[model samples]
Structure formats: structure tokens, C-alpha cells
Target: MANPDECDTMIVGLGAMGSAALHHLASRGVKVLGVDRFVTPHIHGSTHGRTRIIREAYYEHPCYVPIVQRAYELWAALEKEIGERLFVQTGGLMIGPPEGELFAGALRSATEHGLAHTILEPAEVQARFPGFRVPRGSLALHEPRAGLLLPERCVEAHLALARRAGATIRTGITVTGWTADDGVRIATDAGELRARTLILAAGPWLPALVPDLDLPLNVERQLFHWFEPASHPEWYDAAHSPISLIEYADARFFATFPDVGHGVKAGIHHEGAVIDIDAPRAPASAAEGVEMQALLARYLPQAAGRIVDRATCVYTNTPDHDFLLDRHPAHPNVIIASPCSGHGFKFASAIGEILADLATTGETSFDLGPFAISRFQAPAT
Candidate 1:
């Protein structure tokens, strides 16, 4: 009959989104408690890799432009506040056919938002960026604001700032279950705790937390590889090379980043195996490596070199490949924020502020119509 530990708000999962929320909430002087099953900047979740692409002209939809714009401002402010380098501007190119999803979507957003961009022909792309061998009919949409964000460092900065702002963060603690009546009562392996509001940002383990929702969430196993340049090493340098996304064939796409200390980093988007969160994650196999090398040989020939390192990460994807940022349909006090698909790291900064706004004021200024959980709700007869 012990009284449960209490707080104004409790956040589960301390990855990119969770850490940002902690920083924002704690800065507002809210008594917030954040718990993570692993260390804050661990490599198990979706936000580990050294670099994540941050682009202004979102190819997915035009609605993302404003939020990402906000993210840029916040990222710069965070770097200044923490005195840490988190973002690098290498520009970016979306290469594909004029009508392809990558190119057309990026163009649509750029045109809609009046973003600074240019459409480059095949010869232009090849001449300006020697590392790429774009096909004759393909084109490239060059956006100056697109670049790389250092995810691990960003998470570390957020956690550090949150701690300094008086937020209590507990690592290595697993949340078993939670109940919501007047408030939220979370049961963990250590003990039980109570909170006036609960924010569930559990990335891949989100489904396990709310099994009753039966969300159509898929966890995919992804691979990231860094390779030494075999030739024209200068073409792969950060200054010389721009973060590029190639729609090599139809919907199949792969993205690359210039060498930032590590070898040139590359990965195929959404071309990963669906997996369970608890299952043992397998490393990039020989076949996978060969596939990636072949890709490089075809498009980025000079980057086809010795594979220096490989890593595995998971992407918790939603059906529409959009974000899931909404409240639990059954519990108003419980908010669900995960299922970022594969392209969510870039928006974690703004999303953290959005989540904080939602948790504190029950609403946010950003248009979250596309990310609502009710979209998955069945229609009534």
C-alpha cells in the first residue's frame, strides 16, 4: 500500500523524439520524468546512425515543409545553446525521372512553398557532380537547404540540456504497462509511478505498449554501410559532394551522404525485411553488401570501394509512410508518438516541441491532420 511516484508528465522512450520532448518540457519548468530501456544515445533505435538527411523540400508532401522549417530553426538554436555541432549543410539532390515520385514530389513542394531549388538535366548533374552518373532521361532537383543532421550528438545535447533544466531521466528501466483513469499509472519493472499526463514515444516498441489499438505498424530491419572511395576520392568529400537520393528504378530508392570522417554512408530506403522488435537483429549480409556495391557501381561508381563498416537499425513504419503523432483514441491523457516510417529523424526537433505543446495545452499550432491516429480508426456503420 505504498504511494506511487508522481510527476506532472511522464515520457517513455528517450531517443530522438523523447529526448527532445524532455528538453522542451523541462525548460518550461514542468516536473517531467523520462525513462528509457537503454542509454539515451544507444544504437538500438531508429535515431542512432551518425548522419540523417534534413531537407527543406519534402518529397513526401508539402505539409512537411513548415514543420521541417521550424526544425531547422530549433536545430540551429540547440547547437548555439549547447555549443555542439549537430547539422552540416552539404546541399542535396533528388535524382530521378521528371515524373518519378522523388523528383515530382520534391518539385511540387518546392514550387508550392517557393523554396530555392533548381532542376538539373542529366549532363548538368553529371558535370556538376562527377560522383553521380545520372541516366540520360533522369533529372535532379537540387535544394540548397538539404543536408545531414548528426542524430547521436543531437540526442546527447537534448538529454544534457534536459538534465540541466531539472528533468529526471532514468535509463535501463522498462515500462511494463500503463493504466489511464483520472491520470496515468505506469507499471515498470522497478515499481509503479503516476503522472498527470503520459507521452509514449517508444519508437519500435509502441505496438507492445498499446496492443488493443492493433495499429498497422510494421518494423523493418535496415542496413547502413560506409565504404572507402576507390577512385575520385575528392568527389566524395562533404564539400564537393551533396547528399543525394536516387530513384534508380521506379520506386526503388537509395540515399548517400558525403564522407564526414566516416566513409561515404549509403542505404537503400524502405528496402528492408519486416522484423520483430525483440528478435535478434542481423548484420548486413554479404549479399546485401554486394547489392549495395552494385548500386554504387551503377550510379556512384567512385564510391564502390572496400566496405569499411556496416550497421543495423530498425524503422517503425506506418502504412502510409507518414508519422503517427496523436492521442490514444481510448485515453485522452495518453499520447502516442512513434511509427516514423524511415524518414522521421529530420523532424524530431519540431516534433518534440509539438509533443510538448500537445501534452501541455492539448493542441499544437502545426497542422497535424495527416498524423492523427484516428486515420486508422474504422468507419462506423
Candidate 2:
């Protein structure tokens, strides 16, 4: 942040949204300065997981379907621009009881969107995939166009392209505070910078930056464990295996990825310790390891070899598990987005465009009403 007042757009947190916003804004010929406390792709936030799930038929809500649709386009365009593979099409399976959230959500979204999906019985799933064994009453909705997103690479590609497109990306600097007087003035440890607009995609740090907003963003420390496949590593490779989400019990779900560089990354998405982003992640516990062991032994028996590695990431979640993307109710020049509610990485590219659009034109073509701040607005005393 050389000159706080000199920037046309100062974007904080360059991991996913910030990087995307910088690239999009730079491409649109905006003088933008993208700042991050740590250099993005640096494994300090939620976006550092080696891979993130990217399912098209969003069971969380139908509103997310279109956002993901645009995200797919942006990711494809990004892959073309960077010449690096970001998404892998390994059909996705969401398994649960027919009336469970996983099943009902998938069914609702699939029916609403007319997506190509098939509901299969537990035995049918086992017979077809041969890689999975579900409980007797469980079923699966198969979405063919779903897979994983390489998180670090995606961020790197976005930032690299943004720099090439003339966006100044600064890292190793922390924004102490900011204000929107006329445009926006940001005070960082590095220096002061100014922008016509500001975007707060600061993930876990959102509440810290805008304490007045009283945002209900809880940063949970989530873990991903990888294991060497006991059998059929080839089929478990990126080519053959499908990314899986299994809901064995009520509100208990875990997502799994195929063998990437390390091994098979599997973890429970919503279950983890609530963390403050600045603090180090809580150490993995023996009890948690035992739980994962039981989970794998039952849900994913074939590849239950041994735990090879584990890593932690953050999940900034809203109360309803939806995203929060809206301009400041008080400061028009400031746009606040805390969308990565464990499901946001896939939408980063499009979110970058959405942020860029909101910053530049005050609106976007994508329907973001579901993420509006009014949903979290306070009640009168």
C-alpha cells in the first residue's frame, strides 16, 4: 500500500475473491491494488486445501446453482488463460436417506434445475461404482458434471493473470484499519493506499474489520486427512474415482476426493473447532482420528489403508450457511463478501467478477439477493 489514496480499487485478502476481483478489475482496465496479509496461495486461509469440491447441482440451495454456473465458466476461462488444469470431472455422489438433507436437498435442486441426476439405491450404487458401500437404507444422487477444484493453483492463476492485466498485488502486509470517506482509505502495515472502492473478502477476518456490522461469521478450523488406498489406486486416481459426499447420520456428513498428489483427501466439512483465523489450528486429536477411522471403515472401506497426512483450513460460516455478498449499508463505496462457507472456493472466480462488477458498476448480472445483508439485519430495540 504505497499510496492509499492513489488506488482506484483496493482489494483486501487475495486468496480467492480478492484474486478474482483483482484479475477481473484489472482486465476491465481499473487501477486496482490487491492486498493480502499473507501472499495468497500461501496456505494461511480457507483456500489452501489442495482440493475443494465443485458440484453443479447444489443441494444447499437452488440460488447457488446459477452462481456456480457462472463460476464454471470463469474457471474454464481461467484454465484456458493459465494453461493449468483447475477442475476435474469425476462424477459426484451425495448419499443419504431419501428424506435426509443430502438427499432432499439434492432432489429439490435437481428437480428445480432439471439437471441430469439419478437416484440410486445403496446396492445399485455399490454395483455401479464398486468403490463405495452405502448403508442399507441410503441412496445417492449422481451429478455427472461435478468434481474438485485445485485451490492453491486456482488462486495462483487468478493472481498471476491479474498482475499481467495490470493489477498491483501486494502481500506480507496487513491492513490495520480502513475508512470510506469519499472513496476509501486503507491503512496497512506496509503503507497507506486509496481506492475508489474497497472489497472485504477477508474470510475469517471479516468480523474484525467490520465489528460494527456484528457479522455472525464463525471461523471453524476444519481438517483434511489423506490415506494411501489399500487397493485400486489407479481407479482411485483423478481419472476413475468420483468425488463423494456421504451423510451416514443426521447432520453428519463427510466429503472425499480422489487421489491427487498426496492421497485421498477426506474430511467432515461442518464439524470442527471454532477458530479465530489469527490463531494456529488446534492440533488433531486422537479422538478425532479414531472417529475418522470409524467413519472410513464403515463409509469408505475399500481405501481405508492408513492416514498419510493431514492439514487444516478455515471455514467462515454464516448462520444459515449461505454466503454474504452485499455493499456496505453505510458505506456505498465498500463491498463486503464473506462467501466461503466451506462451499465458496468453487464460486471464487465468478465472485471475483461479481465483486468487480459491484465495485465498478454497482450491480452484477448474477442474482445475489439470497446473500444480501438484510437477511442478517438487526432488529430494533
Among the numbered candidates, top lDDT falls to 1
Candidate 2 local lDDT, 298-337, one digit each (tens): 8667676778888778889999999999999889899999
Residues 1-381, candidate 1: write the lDDT tens digits: 122267888999999999999999999988899999999798888988799999988999999999999999999999999998999999999999999999999999999999999899988988999998888899999999999999999999999999999889989899989999989999999999899999999999999999889999999999999999999889998888999999999988999999998899999999899999898898899999989988978888999899999899999999999899998988988999983899999999899999899889999999999998889889778
Which TM-score value belongs to model 1?
Answer: 0.98
Error of 1 at 34 (Å): 0.4
lDDT of 2 at 214: 88
Residue 194's lDDT within candidate 1 is 93
RMSD of 2: 1.5
Residue pair clashes in candidate 1: none
lDDT per prediction? Answer: 0.92, 0.85
True-structure RMSD, every candidate:
1.8, 1.5
How well does model 1 score by local distance difference test? 0.92
